[model samples]
Target: MTCPRCDAATIAFSIPAALRAHLPDDRPGAALCTHCLTVTPLDDPPDDTPSFERVSDAFPANDEAAVAFACVLALLDSLVLYRAELDAVATYAETHGADVLRALERLDADDGVDAHFDVARRTRQLEQFI
Candidate 1:
């Protein structure tokens, strides 16, 4: 995997058995990029780097995007499956569709780009209602 911070190639580091046992998914350990001194858990992406060390802003903040998606989800919770509700969903899809597509494109283009907010998955969730 590439380093999320510097976009450098990453080297895997060995983790003690004690730490590996505690980690979920039977994951091995963490990786480190000597160039940037970034240490990320084996499962976590390099884009999970500290905000201060972030290399780019092409991807939306996960927290902010999650909140936005949650709000849309909340709105969905109360929506009745009717034409008006469907229209509202359609309007939302129309408004955000392009942005979502572009984000997905960026994600596809770069492994360093993190989906911190799981934007693609959440967008799909919203789209299903449309």
Candidate 2:
């Protein structure tokens, strides 16, 4: 990972924090852009950093995104299938929202996913309804 501040290659690392469920709020997925001193993630980066840590805004691995997606699926005023799809994502996150978000933050920051959001494959049925 390249730190926009120092323009250095960084890697994924973790910190000690509380896990409400399986995820830790203080130790969100992050990378060091400036000599391992600057760590940030897709969800919320440090206040000082100006440039984007993640390549894309839509983090597929982001639990927040997943939560958001699930919420969208649940809240979208669409057909039954749309509700079902969002409900599925919401359900999946409801149980493991924390840990999944942690993992997702790592993937999103690392650019491990090819596309922005992979829900297209998972929520294909939504197309027909929309």
Candidate 3:
């Protein structure tokens, strides 16, 4: 799978045990973006949806696809901040961080501002990485 925000390659598995209780059990979990630090629900396009098919590979690789994905991530981040869902952002970052996931996980295990601060800092860090 790929991140809905950054088009960065990722994997979507079952939601973590810690987070399951907070999410909808009926829906399967989606991948979290390591770059944009956003979590998105899986959204599969129809087989006949040619407009969504931009590559021959199992995952998208085209430049257009990358840009679109990144834009989506940015929009999603803005929405989350606007809604003041800091915990959601922290969870997403914790689930997907390349090296800091563990630290984020620890911090998010309880109610605090550290995770939120880290999420904001890391998100800005990713803008440079991109």
Candidate 4:
């Protein structure tokens, strides 16, 4: 699903059972934006939505830094879904120079083979944005 705020692809995250009770009855779940880190309520949950994934529940939902970290991880986990945000990330990296790429390198190093491949593929795609 696309993020309502940034038009970037979103990751489907099931709301924790503990938190579900607190949301309006009509809200089925939530989606996290790969780029802007916006958490949007979903009226109809997606079929592939994960059930309380670690990254979704690892940190408090209100923590901005944690959410951004989670979103980055999620983005790398499935770059195909988060592909649209790569341009935004690449743009920021260009503006900031090597530091941003260094941070991404750190993240890529910690991830699995798929993430490495995705990063490599997306790095090539970033050239178009540049």
Q: Please identify model 2 stretches exceeding 4 Å from their true place.
A: 15-27, 34-36, 42-130
Give the distance in Å from residue 95's predicted Cα in candidate 1 to where it truly belongs: 58
**Candidates 1 and 2, the one with greater lDDT:** 1
**Clash pairs detected, candidate 2:** 61-104, 73-86
Each prediction's TM-score versus the true structure: 0.27, 0.23, 0.32, 0.35
Cα lDDT, all candidates: 0.40, 0.38, 0.36, 0.45
lDDT measured at residue 129 in model 4 versus the true structure, 0 to 100: 45
Global Cα RMSD, each model: 13.6, 12.4, 13.4, 11.9
* Whole-model lDDT, model 4: 0.45
Report the candidate with higher lDDT, 1 versus 3: 1
lDDT of 2 by residue, 1-130 (tens): 5765566665444321222122223344455342323334434434342222343333234444333332332233343534554444444544544233333344435443332244344345443433
Kindly list the per-residue Cα lDDT of model 4 for residues 1-130, writing each as its tens digit. 8877668766675443433443333255667655444566777666553432232333322433333333333344445555565444434333433333444444444422123235545444544443
Question: Weakest 10 consecutive residues, lDDT, candidate 2?
Answer: 15-24
- TM-score-wise, the better of 1 and 3 is 3
Highest-lDDT candidate: 4
Give me the overall lDDT of model 3: 0.36
Clashing pairs in 4: none
Pick by lDDT: 2 or 4, better one: 4
Which lDDT value does model 4 have at 126?
42
